[model samples]
Target chain A: MSASRHRLGRLIGNAVLLAAVATTLAPLLWMLVTSLRPKQDVFDGALPSALTFDNFSAVLHSVDIGRQLLNSVIFAGGVTLGQLAIGIPAAYAFSQSRGRWSRWAFAVLLLTMSVPFVVVYLPNYILLSEVGLLDSHAGMILPQVASAYGIFLLRQHFQAFPRAIVEAARIDGASEWMVLWRVVVPASRSAISALAIFVFISTWNEYVWPQLVAGAPGMQTLSVGVAAFASEEAGTQWGSIMAAATIACLPTVAAFLALRRQIFNVLLEGAVKG
Target chain B: MAPALLLFGAFVLWPIARTGWLSLHDWNLVSPDREFVGLDNYSELLGDPDFHRLLGRTLMYVAIGLVGGFLLPVGLAMLTLRHAGRATGVYQTLLFVPTVITTAVGALVWQFMYLPSGGPVNELLDTVGISPVNWLKDPSTALPAVGVVGAWQNLGFSYMIALAGLSAVSPTLLEAAELDGASGWQLLRHVVLPLLMPTLLFLATTAVLHALPNVFVAIEILTSGGPAGSSSNLLYDVYSNGLRFFRVGEASAEAVVLMALIGGAAVWQMRLIERGVTYER
Candidate 1:
């Protein structure tokens, strides 16, 4: 009887976890379902009476979603590239060096990380406009690339780099840059790729900054484009709006699924700091 | 280092200093009209009834978010901790799915779901023999409705954090407790919950810090803090003040208040992590 009770408890436990999973994914699943239903029948019910992919075509064909998707790719890629170029080196300096200036730089990164973006939003806008970058992709991507948290996270990863290998490379007459390129970067591929995916997903999904900086739909990223699609559709055009949203969401979801372990690692690492 | 610092100054530090400077002056973003107000903006803000309401509402959001972030994750962690084996990884990946999707997109999807006219959420209510409620319309339910979206999106990340914390507990210790005749309640209270404290505190503090800025996207898409500004939080209100209404000085002052508030929370959270990590070690 006691053994049966334990089995019963285990049964109940799995059931509850499954329920949690179902609840968590229910809205996202609904978003996917809405995206595929015929436009006219989108309001019919939760389950599609009939399914069609016309909504996808409508979003891609009628709207500037295609351009925006490309723009998102470019935007995310550009920021990722920009950040890795700047942040990796900074992480190297911070992790390997015992210099006062390197310590000061890390402190600066941490300080800037603490200052939430809203406090500086207006001033950044004014500065961007002063620099003649308003309504441009540069305005949207540039501010994000200088991520203080990125430096901090990479520093964590860099500190875990085996110091002996670096010491060997340096003793063999390798320059600092040469050591970084040949030893550190190659060794830290997993962490760097994970960081790249993190940056890409974040910069791709950034709505508020892009909405503020990229004025017109023509210049907007996929996130802003779909948001605009939703407002224009309201409740009337759920199909196309869902399609746009699904398009905006696809890359990140796909990335998460593909690189589950790595992305999950970053999530836990960057959990509280974000 | 030079390049990152230069951009950091241009984007983060200089702008923060400018926000401070802007808070003291009565000037729009670009208008030639300007005046030095000398703490007038802040004094006026302190006396403002709407600001008070906004603060109260903001705290309400934080509380609701904490309930979702804290209880839901703890519940999930407790359920799956023992049952965790082969099936555990799959369930975890499923739950962590939401944290990856663009929140802007997530917010819009919620907008469609919370539709007043024949939305899926109301239809589900109908199936339960309850009448449809305007999830995003009624002032009484509006904030909670938006807050639910915040909760749903947050549950996954919080669950992950709790899981991370739960994993930190040694299996030997739990098995030892079980061998000591601990089951269910005693096992949890005596062995599990105490070990989870640091992580829970970290989650709670971060939840409070995340309340404002993160919810801005959801609120913007879902309600625009509308139906009488019932759902508006501090971040959204400040954004509207500065961006939409051109009340630069008042908005900057509001921004400063929020900055100090979040800055305090972030510092507290960092300290918590620092202490918690060492304590765990």
Candidate 2:
């Protein structure tokens, strides 16, 4: 009787866990299902009777989706590249420096991370407008490239890096730049790559900055463009909106699937330590 | 270091300082002229009933987020600990799918789900012989509906953190507790929760802090804080007033208030950690 009770408990546990999974995925599943059916049949049921690529075609034809997607790539890619280019050296400096000064600097960086983007967005917008960068890709990418979070993450990895490797490279008369590139970077490739993937995915998912800055049709990122389309179409045209959402979601979701292990590792480390 | 500081100073430090200054003046975006308005905006905000309602709604969102985002995932993570196996990896991967997806796109999909007429959510409700409720259109439900989208997106992150914490709870301790005749539920409550307290505290603090900002995209896309600003939060107010309406000074004031509230939250979190709630063993 006790053994059966334990089995019953296991059954209930599996049931609850599966329900959580179903609840989490039901919306995405609905999105794909609705995108396949005809627009008029969206309300028919959960499952589509027949599938078609017509909605995808209609979404592609209706807007300059290609341009928006290209913009997203450039925006996310630029921010990622720019962040690594700047954040690596900054993290190295923080890691190598000694004294209360570095501690103070790190404290300031931590404080900056906690300041919500909404707090500074107004002044940043005004600054961008003053510089004639508003509604431009530069405007969206420039302010975001300096991420305290990235610098903080990289700094943690750099702090734990082996000091002997750096000293050996220094003894060989390597310049600071050379040491960074040839020694430190190659040694910490995994961490750096993890940061890159994260920065890229997050920048791709950014909405408010792109929506606020990219007023021009040509400069809007994929997420922003899809959002505009979704809000404009609202309750009517469910098929096209779902198709746009599916298209917008595909890149990051695909990336997550491919890089799940690395992503999970970074998230686990960051969560436990931070 | 120099380049990073330069960029941070330009974008973050300068902008924050500028926002503080801008809050003390009255300047519409189009106007070339600026008038000094010391504390008037603050006083007005304090007096305004709408602003109070926005703050209350913002707190409501935080409460919902605490339950849905933090507590639910943490509880689920603990449950999965009992059924740990190869399939745990699959559950982790699938649950985290929403975290990687675009919030704007996810909100759009939920917009479809919450449609009043024969939407999937309503269809499921109808199968149980219940009447349809207008999810997004009704003022009472709009804020919670938008808040849930943020909670959903946040689930994977919180779940991963909780799972890591649970796994860190030493197996030897569990075995010892079981040897002491503790039942499964007793072991969970007496052994695991205390060991997991630090992680739980961190998750709680982040849930409160992230609630407002996380919901901003949903509010913008799903409802635009609609049905007469019923769903608007503090961040959305800052966006609409500053960017949309171009009331730069007033918006900056709102922004300043938001920063103070966030700063206060962080300080409280630090105090909570310093109070020694973490279990040594």
Candidate 3:
């Protein structure tokens, strides 16, 4: 009787979690389904009676989504590479340095994570315009390259590296650059990659910053482009709007799925100060 | 190090100082000169009834976020510890999927989901004999509706953190509690919940700090802060005042106030992390 009761408990537990999962995924699934339905048949039901790729084609044809996608790639990729190039060295310096002042400096840097972009974007926007970088890819990518969260997370990972390995590398006459590139970096590949993926995903998803700086028609990232498309056309075009959203979402979603384990492992580290 | 500091200074630190300076003067975007306004902008902002409403609504958004993003995740995380079996990883991965989606796209997807006629949410409501609600258009529901979307996107991240906290609780202690004749609820309430407080507090703090900014994308995409500024918050107001309408001085003052608010939370957050580390040890 106890065994059967325990089984019933497990059965009920599974049911609850499954329901939660369904509720969580239902909206995304509906987005995909609605995007595929015939324009007139969007409200017909949850699942489309027939699949159609015309919405995707229509949105692509109507808007410069292809250019926007490329722009997103360049913008996100540039920001990611720039952050990693700068961040790895800075994180390396922080992890290697020893003293109270260094610790305080690191703390100060981490505190900047809480400084909301809305507060700073106005000045940054003006500064960029003053320098004539506004509405350009460099403008969008440049201001965001130095991320406190990235440096902090990378420092955490770098701190975990074995000190003995570093000592041996130094004794073998390895320069500081070699010590970082040849010794510590190769070992910290997973952390670096995880940070890269995060930076890329975030840069890709960024809305307000890009919207403010990259306002030009040819330079609009996928996020600003899709949002602009939706607000203008939402009154009459559910299918095409969903299609644009799907396009905007695909790259980040794919990156997250492919690197989920690294992401899940890094969550505890990020949450400590995130 | 030099390069990184230069970049950080140019972007983050310098802008903060510039904003503080800008807050003291009146300047439009196109103006060549800024007029010194002293505390006038602050006084004007403080005296405005609309600013008070925006502040209140911003707090409401934070409360909504605490419940939906922080509190609800705690419950869900506890539930996951039971009977999830081998599919635990799969469940977690699927749940976190929403967090990676672009905020703008996520808002657009939700705009469609909350569609008044024949949308999925209303269709679900219709099955229960309830009439379809105009979720976004109606002023009364727009704020909460948008708040719910922010919470939904954030729920996965918070849940993962809570689950990690739950897993860190020693099973031996749980067994000892059971041996001492403590009921399941007693063990949970007395032991598990206390241990989870640091994680929960962290989530709550982030939820509060992030509530206004995170909802910016949704508000811009879905309602543009709405049908009469009904859904507008302080952050949205700041954006409009600064960028859209070019009220530079007033907006900078608002930005200063916002930074102070978030800065206080960040200090609290740092203290919480320190305490949490010592507690864990």
- Candidate 1 lDDT, B1-281, residue by residue in tens: 77888888888888778888889999987798789989999999999998999999999998887888877787788667776667878888899888788889888888878876678888888888988888787898989888888887777778877777666777666655655563656876876668767778887886676666667788888888988999998888878788878888988899889888877787787777778542221
Per-residue lDDT of A228 in model 1: 81
In angstroms, give how far residue B225 of model 3 lies from its true place.
Answer: 1.3
lDDT of 3 at B153: 84
lDDT of 2 by residue, B159-245 (tens): 887777667677567545544554867876877668777778877897888788788888988788888999998889988898888
**Which candidate should be chosen as best, given DockQ against the real structure?**
2
lDDT per residue for candidate 1 within A219-241, as digits (tens), equals 88888888887777756778888
Could you report the Cα RMSD, in angstroms, for every candidate shown?
Answer: 2.4, 2.4, 2.2
Off by over 4 Å in 3: B171-186, B278-281
- What overall lDDT, based on C-alpha atoms, would model 1 receive against the true structure? 0.81
Candidate 1 backbone collisions, by pair = none
lDDT values for all models: 0.81, 0.85, 0.84
| Residue pairs of candidate 3 with colliding backbone atoms | none
